[model samples]
Target: MGALGAGIAALGAGIGVGMIGSKATESIARQPEASGDIRTAMIITAALIEGAALFAIVVGLLSNG
Candidate 1:
């Protein structure tokens, strides 16, 4: 069960990061001049999502043991 939860958390994070990247790419395409800003925001948001996901996965695994 814990492993299942961890897998779900990782999956959710992957989807979230993918969506963020997709939108960032679209935004940059629409405004090449703001590409730097869009890329920065995307990286920051992805990092945050990853951090939360990591925390959740750790907790889930620990709960199993």
Candidate 2:
């Protein structure tokens, strides 16, 4: 169960990062001038998502342990 939960959290993190990259690319394409801002925002959002995912994985591992 712990392994399963951790895997799910990892999958969610992958999906979230992918979506963020895609959206950031689209935004940059649409507004070349704001690419810098878009990239910064994307990075920040991805970081937050990653942090949550990491926490979830840790919790799952601890529960199984």
Q: Root-mean-square deviation of each candidate, in angstroms?
A: 0.5, 0.5
Which runs in model 2 stand beyond 4 Å of their true positions? Answer: none
Tens-digit lDDT track for model 2 on 1-56?
A: 99899999999999999999999999999999999999999999999999999999
Clashing pairs in 1: none
Query: 1-65 in candidate 1: lDDT tens per residue?
Result: 99999999999999999999999999999999999899999999999999999999999999997
**TM-score, every prediction:** 0.97, 0.97
Off by over 4 Å in 1: none
Model 2 C-alpha RMSD to native: 0.5
Error of 2 at 4 (Å): 0.5
